[model samples]
Target: MAEVKLFGAWGSPYCCRIEVALKLKGVEYEFIDEDVHNKKSPSLLKYNPVHKKVPVLVHNGKPICESLVILEYIDETWEEGPSLLPKDPYERAMVRFWTKFLDEKCMPAMRKACLSRGEEQERAKEESTELLKFLEGTVSGKKFFGGDNIGMVDIVANFISYWFIIGQELVGLQVLTKEKFPKLGEWMDEYLNTIIIKENLPPKDKLTAMFQARFEAAATATATAAAAGGGGGGGGAPK
Candidate 1:
């Protein structure tokens, strides 16, 4: 029997991605839920000292950090299950490419849109929508980003199907919509309805509440900072 353990947060989409992969691969892992909003655990720190983040996969006592990296590791390590990456080199390359675009480009812009206000928020929303257009086109006529079935890109893009939609609603930012990206919306519906994904998703109500509280706290902190800056700057013009 293999010793497999995962340190992750219940509300995190990153963690959910790993869990989905593990389940898809029929790998049983001990899940250690971490309170990422507060202090992290010593074990998590020990595994990923640099990021000190959740979704760390510890297999046979060796820790693998980062969700994407861990996803690849799981796919390679377990040969019994359905392959996450395609067998063809070109197809695999495309998968990696889109996944990179999602994490490096789409995710950040969507998050910024959610967290910012005014011009900044508008800019981020526009950027996110533009980024999503590419995905919309890519997934056109395809049931999943992986084509026909769920694959690496589909797993990596799990955030778009659930987390980002919830986030956009909470912050009153509408970056992704069915009307704007019909193909992508259809893909989301199909992907989320899959047995593996549907069963493993975080409870919608719980996730919504968590995101609501987080957005509220961020807004409060931003207001407090602005008020403090307003009071201080009037008294001094760089004295």
Candidate 2:
């Protein structure tokens, strides 16, 4: 058996993506939760020298950085069950296109919603709505992004399903609603109902409490820093 290890964080949706992909593939690997904010471990630095990001997968002592890259590597390595990428070249390219789009467009809106304030927060909300609209339009009739079974693009896009709900509460905004985005709302239900996804999700109550506390703490810190005349500005909100 190859020695597989994963460096991740508990509350990060990015980390959850890798965990879900690994579970869906039924791959056995040791999970090492890293303190991404506080202090990263020596091994995490050694493995991911470039980005120093979490969700780094080490297979047979070789490191794969970035969640999407790691997911692709995992799918290619373990070719037993469901395949992540489509067999058809055109379809595969389409999936890659959407995955990259989600990372670039959708993800930035989420980040802005998480950390921004005042006018920045309003701008983030507008951008987030546009992205959600695009997603709803795209997934109108598709069973999954891959057409049937879940695929790499679906895995990457799945973050919006669960994490968006938490963001709704944390950011004090409602981006997704059954009335507004009915098709996407139904798609979220289908995605969550999948046994593999449902089984691997973090506890809801626990996650809610975690996010709520984090938001409150950040708010308090921001207020305190402002009162102290300290400089801590810029960057979009959390997702």
Candidate 3:
């Protein structure tokens, strides 16, 4: 038997990606829930000293950090299950390109749309919508990014189907809507409905509650910063 363990935070979409991959591969792993937001665990620190982040996969005493890296490792290590990525080199490269676009381009813009206010929020919303439009075209006439089944792109984009939806709802920011991007919307519905994905998802209510708290904290921080900036404009002289 192989010794497989995973260190992850419950609410993180990045961590959830790894969990979903492991499940898809039918790999039984011991999940060590770590408080990534509050305090770091000794084991987590030891395994991922540089990043000190969650979603670290330890297989046979060797640690693999980063969700995307861990996902490829899971797929490669377990050959019995359905392929997470394509075997063709060019096809695999395309998958990596889109995943990178999602994480680097789409996600940040969507997050900013939710966290920023006024002009910045509008810009972020526009950017996110444009990025999503590209994805809409990519997924057009397809049930999934993998053509008919879940694949690397679908797994990497897990955040869009769930986390981003909940976050945009909490902030009342609508960068992604079925009316605006129907193809991507349909893809989301299909991805979320898959038995494996549906079974593995964290409870929606719990995820929403967590997002609400984070949004409140961000609002408080922004207000405090604004107040401090206003107070500091005294021209270094007492009038």
Clashing pairs in 1: none
Residue pairs in clash, model 2: 111-237, 112-237, 114-237, 114-238, 115-237, 115-238, 116-237
Candidate 1 lDDT score relative to the true structure: 0.85
Candidate 2, residues 135-194, lDDT tens digits: the string is: 888888988767778888778887688876776766778777778889888888888899
TM-score against truth, every candidate: 0.93, 0.90, 0.95
TM-score, cand. 2 vs. native: 0.90
CA lDDT, every model vs. true structure: 0.85, 0.81, 0.85
Of candidate 2, the 10-residue stretch with the lowest lDDT total is 230-239
In model 1, where is the ten-residue run with the lowest total lDDT?
230-239
For every model in order, what is the number of clashing pairs? 0, 7, 0
> Can you write out model 1's per-residue Cα lDDT over 1-239, one digit (the tens) per residue?
99999999898888999999999999998999997767888898899999888889999999999988999999999998889999899988888898899889988887777776667678888899889989988999888877787888999898899999998888777678998989988998899999999999999999888877777766676677678884211110000
lDDT for model 3, please. Answer: 0.85
Give the Cα error of residue 9 in candidate 1, in Å: 0.4
Cα lDDT over the full model 2: 0.81
